[model samples]
Target: MWGRRPARGTIVKICGLRTIDALEASIEAGADLAGFVFFEKSPRHLTLDAARALVARAAGRIGMVALTVDADDERLAAIIAAIQPDFLQFHGHEAPERVREAKARFKLPVIKAIGVGGREDLVAAKAYAEADMILYDAKPSPGAARPGGMGRAFDWGLLNEAPREKPWLLSGGLSPETVAEAVRITGAPGVDVSSGVESAPGQKDPSRIAAFLHAARGAAGGEAR
Candidate 1:
């Protein structure tokens, strides 16, 4: 997976995909990455068998990401054997040491999702030195059903001066209407969307997916494919 270096454009990841239509739409839209949620509470959560089937369809066409929330090694091992994702996204409260350990044990790249609200959160994300990439998403509301995919957004200005120590993605509350502005404001090299392109929670719309990719690419100064 590391061998397929990102192309010369802003990386776009459409997360929480669950169907052949959504998977095919992502690939057809030239998305750099496709994400699958594995957290049980998430509406977009997928069974190992289902994820494996989607991964088989996506073979070599796009990067597959397995997203989890504080999963233990047994769970992680099971996911690795089944989905064979190119990257593991730790969207929970896994410490830097845990992130490092997972990379060592699994022999795969890791993407650590940091809940961002202010400058301090950005500073703390640097601790994940071993993470191949970092994803900055909005912090969930109190007692929210899930940590992410809530469709809330933080101030894009918060990342205007963020240090470029690691590759990062801007997420949260982005839609086809706003992704261009987000990319312009944050100057993020990558952007990720889940609920933004969905017709509803857990339901992806191909037209919206295409529109988002178009906007994101234009904002990144690349012509839309």
Candidate 2:
């Protein structure tokens, strides 16, 4: 929740969480935020009723994030009414103008997710300064069905070459085994995981969830570059 923040270190967000066991696993493990996917195209997508229930279950224990991609105002209105999320994550090809409009309309912190396929994408991320935060995830390959949640990773070295002043979240191809290295390399203040912690697409394994959170916190405070 707003008051229950993660400790002073890297922010760890477990995204695409669907069930109560997985949700509790993240909170008990001291995650800063838990994200729910709203896109139907994703295997991890949740129905409006399901998202509402999960958000209610969080009960301010962890920051509740509603993730969407290229959604219009009418759809967002219904989602906000149902979930009332703490943050809105735009994981689509939303332009800077769209991000600004969403922030103004929702009056909530908006996290703009950029598809990082190359060094040039970092430059793209900087354009949305009006966004409350930025999320750097691997670009979905051409002809891919979705924008993200493919569990593919981009070149982490690109972030080192092009840095931004605003806080951002690092995602893509992160699991318990490689998350420490990712944090060590990028100095990302936050990290988001979806498929990496799953037993299968849309199925969350509590054990993997616990392990990822443990590994992330252990690596959070280290120096980067």
User: Which candidate number maximizes TM-score?
Assistant: 1
Over the full model, what C-alpha lDDT does candidate 2 score relative to the true structure?
Answer: 0.84
Model 2: per-residue lDDT, tens digit, 1-225? 222224556688999998999998888877878998999988889999998888888967988889999999998889889988889999888899998998888898898888888877788877897888888899888888888838887888788965566778889999988898998898777899999999888888878877887777779752211
- Model 1: residues >4 Å from true position, as ranges? 1-8
Model 1, residue 183: displacement in angstroms?
A: 0.6
What is the lDDT of every predicted structure here? 0.89, 0.84
Q: Quote the positional error of residue 84 for candidate 2 in Å.
A: 0.7
- C-alpha TM-score for every candidate: 0.95, 0.93
TM-score of 2: 0.93
